[model samples]
Target: MRPSLSAFKIRANMKPILITGYVNPDLDGTAGMIGYAEFLSKTGKNTVAGVIGEPHEEAKYILDRFNIPYPLLLANANDYDEIVLVDASDLNGLEGKIDPNKIIEIIDHRQAHETDKFPNAKAQIEMVGAAATLIAEKFIKNNLEISKNAAILIYGAIISNTLNFKGSVTTDRDKAAAEWLNKTARLPENFWQELFSAKSDLTGEKLAERIEGDFAWFVLGDKNVGIAQIEIIGADKLISERGEEIIKILDKIKDEMQLDYIFQNTIELLDCKNYLVANDEKTKKLLEKILDIHFVGISAVRPNLIMRKQIIPLLKVELEKN
Candidate 1:
């Protein structure tokens, strides 16, 4: 017996799967989405990479410098029947744009995530330094040749997210992925410095823009916490000159968002340390307890680099204890 018309209708109506990252995605998110979309397409799957918000300046720098094509800018994922998220697993990152029910797969590296919220997604939430590493592994394992554009993006993302492999979250896998991608990327020896320097420019209003653009907030236990991270070359100079401005921005955002605690983690690329800025006593005390550093005036110095993703789990555990 012949199959019914419904079988033909199902085949004809299937849409290309939409792949994207979080709202206002960083390099890791953008790279993962672009690379993974290419991987799927090369493997005989229909996929289209898209972005919900503007790509971060660092990501744009690599894209423009290497003349890589930008992913499709989408307002929402309503047009697609199935969606895949890369470097994003939380609903807050979606900003009420993409429906979690439509998500079919998730690839993220955050230790503290809301993967359970996306009940329909098959997730690969690892503890690597960057989500781009996971995407690179897919291509390597399948013996697929990654294009130069994807290689550069993914390589830069791994370097950026891992702070050039100096960050505490860096693993052997991230290093391996970067080594493999560089063969195709063929980036300059000083590419990491160039990448970091591109984002180090916080002149005029750019400082405020970078802080607000990279800020992330979470509800841990019963407290609303906000974390703003900046990876730059001159963290000390920025704090010394515009420390008051930083406090003002944090204060304004805290009041507007009604956050219980907030702080800025400034990772100084050259010095390989973190200058944590917090204006309030509560936030200062919390950092002192968890980070083992005392706040001098409005900021504290952490000798080693620690990204926001590494701090979230510590915050969650500490907050939940109180």
Candidate 2:
């Protein structure tokens, strides 16, 4: 049953509810921050959508389409009734904008405080692909009407984070949540397809520079190891045109970053196989190589796209072997 609305509702005189994103708000964080803000406002509190990082283009479209107001900047932290942290990993960085005692809730989809970092948080760490999916569940569980804009934002977040549900970390829960919400939001299929097709620079880069930008952290032994996601579309063409450059830079990355291992991954979306450029024969034979089925485009595991999908489980497998 839902709680009583009377206690939750604020008089018009109350401070605007601030809805802020993670330190660097990506599509997931941006969508979750705003979508959750919309839900909170429907419960009768004035809301302000905040961002430590700016929203991406698609998210900006949703915000504009929904007519959601841009939130006031956090010049100083002492501003709102309760500080809501969406995709926020660190509370200290946002110190001046929120009182340590005033934070009421934290919501995210990533692994929460494996190191016992945030002692003061009442956070939702559900290990799903996207935080937007969780906020959608909260609305449905509470029986709130989801706005059209909310749907698009969350859906975009899911699609981006899950890499069109192809990322290994994606689960049935993530699939179900995105499926349910997208029905009402009613965005065109081609729209998303075209939107996602905008390729980032996976090709022309040094491995060291590439890994820093595209990595997600996972526990490897005592240290938190970072695995990078490098996606290039055509296997043969990429090899012919840029393979030498890739190998050179990747070797450079191995030395520069001191990586335990690097998986230079390529995905031809048309063909499902994942090709990896590894540092050595030992690293090459690591994951998926054990299965050893090479068809037109075949591999048992596609572990290079998203580390959450590929690296985390691979770490578990590697740890057991050693």
Candidate 3:
């Protein structure tokens, strides 16, 4: 996504503090950035939410439905005077726009790594289910008023990240935050179902966008691997209907990006399971070795794998092995 240069204009004595989430931000990432930036603003901080890329389809739908504004689209994080990261801590998670030294604070709910690089930054990295849970707790604990829009965004994120608290990675904190936000947001009981349905409705170009936008790269033993995750319902139906098309796109991406390995996983949010795909035999062998799961055709059924947060780290460990 191109950065809006007009949004980057700086004024004297007003060193803008840019609050950004991880690259190709999902619902939780976008929501966490907005919520945390608003919290900082309440405390007299000159911070604005920045986005590394366009919001995901579901996220855009929610924001538009609720009339919440999108974060400032940023091509590079270095354009700001100071940076505060929300929902992601590692430099790899960022869009490679800023020096690591520019980060002054990090509020995340992911496993920490390479934190020593930011020796002076305030790092509050928790292993909660969703980063929005941490931001919601801050709002309540600090007695800060949450705008209706913020409440909707944060609440939706908690639900999305936690898979309505059914995913294996969900925690009590995520549920509690959702409960509190529920009281204020008063979202309809059907909201979660509707959101999941909307997310599952990807097709053709939308499906392609989802795959490409959500893709992430990792370095393992000098090999670059890519993982793209899709959170949807009725994953089996989608895979059966469009698996070939999806794999074709992923294959093209793998070659174009010169990735050593690439895989796409369809997370069935309703069933709390995963369907994995490897673009080639080499990656298939690696995945089989790494996951120890049998494959059917080009796909593997991992009924227990629910979160990329869990799968990515697991793959990294195995990839490092040899």
RMSD of 2: 7.3
CA-only RMSD, every prediction: 2.0, 7.3, 5.3
Alpha-carbon error at 20 in model 3, in Å? 1.1
Off by over 4 Å in 3: 1-13
* Candidate 1, run of 10 with poorest lDDT: 7-16
Best by TM-score: 1
Please provide, for model 2 over 176-290, each residue's C-alpha lDDT reduced to its tens digit, 9 standing for 90 to 100.
8888887877867655455454443344444344444444544465433444455434554664566566666666666765766555555544344566545455456654444
Q: Better model by TM-score, 1 or 2?
A: 1
**TM-score for each model:** 0.97, 0.67, 0.91
lDDT of each: 0.94, 0.61, 0.83
Off by over 4 Å in 2: 1-18, 45-47, 54-83, 88-104, 111-115, 166-172, 200-212, 231-240, 243-259, 265-268, 280-310, 316-322
Q: Report the number of backbone clashes for model 3.
A: 0
Residue by residue across 26-120, what tens digits does model 1's lDDT show? 99999999999999999888999999989999999989998989999988888988899999999988999999999999999988888889889
Candidate 2: worst-modelled 10 consecutive residues by lDDT: 291-300
TM-score of candidate 1 to 2 decimals: 0.97
